[model samples]
Target: MADEKRRPRPAAQYGPTAALVARNVERLRKTRNLTIYSLSAELGKAGRPITPSAIAKIEKMQRQVNVDDLLALAVVFGVSPAALLLPLEDSPRHTAEITGAGAVPADSAWAWASNKRPLKFPPGEQRTAEMEYALASLPPNAREARQHPAGRAIEAAYEDVTRVIVRAAWSVEGDEHEFIDALDQARASLERTLAELGRLAVEHEELVRLRDGVPREGSD
Candidate 1:
């Protein structure tokens, strides 16, 4: 058996988020007229040396991006890392006049397009219980729509995605087969995480009602 075949797959810990990032990456890269090869060369000049193929994989969500990759991309695009991570709605506003690929003033061409402030979590391993506690303590009424376990899982999953992207972007020696397998497993885990969070939310609400001395919908 070939070593590549024997190795585990790449985990898709941040599958959807990675896919979203990839779209943004592609969109922004195009805005700057960068081909995949050009982007690869730029990264190589910066000591990262991401191959065109790997870049393709990332954009396609078949691979991941790491912290280093994100940083390099930020530099290449002349945008903040936060800009790269911001939701699609916050991507640079496009105008027909600016669509032709020539020089565009950064200020007028692209501003973080979000009306609301985005949540800022500590990047990488620095995220700890303090963050979780803070998230949990947000007034329940204030967060009733999105402060659920599913939302937190999505946030954590985004972090995991950045890690996976870093690994896939920087490590060229790993078994490709195993790396791909890891991605598959990670994606599965994310799906399960979402499902489990939904189940827990229902149970948690019922428990909260009981603890607070509230009756069930049909109580005597």
Candidate 2:
């Protein structure tokens, strides 16, 4: 029984998410120019050692990735665990096969994996109280602010500005024109983000007033 448990199962027996993880692990390893041996070494340094043979089996979908393996791999690859579980392609037209969820749009799969949305909605297409509680239970960084559309726009704008600033700081000689253009773009993005923030602040204040039963200005 132990030998049978140790043996590699047929590909059909592996879950869809497991197959996706195997493919992504191999892809990310090759993209980073690391061999299985090197990845194994890195994993060992990360305190979750897997032999090269086991890593090879994992890449080939002959072995299952446990939760600890998933977390360790994410750390080694410098990515979130969701990145390994979801499809690399984010095209809405394409589909990803999830184990219990069956096939869902690739983008939706990514959103669900990243906690931007639920994997499946309740009947009537409304979020349940449990779902709301689950979302509320997330850390502040992982909650609605980061997942909401407006918040995402703000975050994206910040990233754009940060990217430009980094490029400018490390800019090579004779790249003045390119750096200036990037600075202009960053400035525009920052302005837009600021405007959005101001709008949200006003909206929040109004909500507070309403919740406190305060009358609107110039109203009876």
Measured against the true structure, the TM-scores of the candidates, in listed sequence, are 0.39, 0.62
Segments in model 2 whose C-alpha atoms lie over 4 Å from true places: 1-12, 122-124, 127-137, 140-196, 199-220
Q: Tell how far residue 164 is off in model 2, in angstroms.
A: 22
- State the lDDT of candidate 2 residue by residue for 10-111, as single tens digits: 464678888889999999999889999999999999999999999999998888899999999999999999889988876555899999989998866876
Instruction: Name the candidate that leads on lDDT.
Output: 2
lDDT by residue (108-218, candidate 1, tens digit) is 233312211123334663345334544565456534433456765665565455445645754587656645765765686688678868888889999999899998888
Best by TM-score: 2
Error of 1 at 77 (Å): 0.7
Candidate 1: segments with Cα more than 4 A from true spot: 1-11, 90-220
Question: Candidate 2, overall lDDT?
Answer: 0.81
